[model samples]
Target: MGRIVRVISKDASVVCSAIDGKDIVSRIEEIHKTSAVVTAALGRLAMGTSLMGFGLKGKDDSITVKMDGDGPTGALICVSDSMGNVKAYVQNPVVELPLNDKGKLDVRGAVGSNGTLSVVKDMGLKEPYCGQVPIVSGEIAEDITNYLAVSEQVPSVCALGVLVNPDLTVNCAGGFLIQLLPFAPESAIDQIEKNINGMESVTKLICGGMTTEAIAMKALEGLEPNVLDDFEVNYRCNCSRERVENALISLGRAELEDLSKDGGTDVECHFCDKKYHFTPEEILGLIKE
Candidate 1:
């Protein structure tokens, strides 16, 4: 099963929240079935969203993250609930990138350096809280941290990573988020910063067989964190033929009539790249009804 762990790391003057969602990212990567770089970016974003979403307070609270870029990837979107459930997709997932200097998938090249990352939180309210920040690194983790600091006014350190195999498969994927609560002590901040800078690559740690709990613990060594919860997540989509039909019907009677006269229509899902066909008769019926 896909695994995800959330922990609250605290020292005398600071409290840090860290989430490691390795397996869940990998599972989502599998569904995209795209190029290595695309999968890496998607996986990283998914992991980041899951981590952030799981950090919410209300039992039924949820968060949605959207990245609409000027790059070939077009847009990257993901949603996560407090229960650690996450779903995400890219508008164009077939784009590939030349290997970077490190001989690894170049996620920034695929995601583009220009765009915006927006987060919207739903707390079962009439209007959800929204925050947006300009994309900083396109690498995902840094952008998330930037969102927290600039948009939400929260000081945070977030790191997300995904290693893609030469065969275009995922080797490892995970991330950690460290948030500095308000009025945290200076020494606590210094130690946590040192720990973060000295820590090994998150992907390497996870691929090396480190559990999520263990990774969080190592990052929070001196700090004592009260374990909150652990959860398993996977790639899931809420799309269906019914939803597609509703969208098409929303085109109005005129468009439906035109489609009926022409030979119906064909629609493809941007998320899953699946197509649905509609017959002319069906279009006519839709227009009539």
Candidate 2:
């Protein structure tokens, strides 16, 4: 299980959230069989979504983040519940590219820049809240920061990272989100900026045995931070046979009848690749309901 720690400055002018998501990313990589670059890209998105979802006020609230880019990866999608459980998938898990000039995995090249980053928040309301912004860097972190600052009108700094081993296993994965609340003083903002500027990369800090709480403290070093909450999170797929059946029912009687002609059908979840089979009789039964 991964852990998340949320903190607020003593003056309540800023909030910082951090996650150590190695286990979550490892489970996702195992399920998706993603290439190095894709793992890094999706992992970063999942962690960022988890951090964002932690801010939801309702127990049942959830957030979905989607990146539709022109790169080979196609689209990367991550969903997180208020409790921090996350599930994610990429349109092309096998897509890979050569290392970039930085001699690192070319995440930006794989994610592409020509696209949009969209977020939807479901708070059990009549209509969910939606926001969208053009992809800024396709580097995941920068794009998330851009979305927060532009669409959400929150000045935030986001940093996400994933380190994949030579054998394609996750070594460490995590991220941090620091947001300046409205009416925040200039001194608080400057202190937060200085703290972030002097800190190491998230992955490096995790690799050095720093916990999420420590990361939050580092980001708010001079701000007298206080821990608000700490909790565990995981890459959890909520898909079930019942949910699949409900989805199939939503296709309408005509569609159900057509599907029943085939004797049976199989549905696979995009997030977890779990397959559910339904017999023709079952399909017809759903039609009667």
Q: Kindly provide the TM-score of model 1 when superposed on the true structure, using C-alpha atoms.
A: 0.86
TM-score of each: 0.86, 0.98
Per-residue alpha-carbon lDDT of candidate 1 for residues 3-119, written as tens digits (9 for 90 to 100): 666566554344444445555666665666778788888888888888888778898898999988777888999988886678888888788668889887788888888989999
**195-239 per-residue lDDT for model 2 (tens digits):** 988999998999999999999988999999999999999998899
After TM-score superposition, what is the CA distance of residue 69 in candidate 1 from its true location, in Å?
A: 3.2
Q: Which ten residues in a row have the lowest lDDT in candidate 1?
A: 10-19
Clashing pairs in 2: none
What is the lDDT for 75 in model 1?
Answer: 92
- Measured over all alpha carbons after superposition, the RMSD of each candidate to the real structure, in angstroms, is 2.8, 1.0
- Return the number of clashes found in candidate 2: 0
Question: Which candidate number would show the highest lDDT if scored against the true structure?
Answer: 2
lDDT of each: 0.78, 0.94
Badly placed stretches (over 4 Å) of model 2 are none
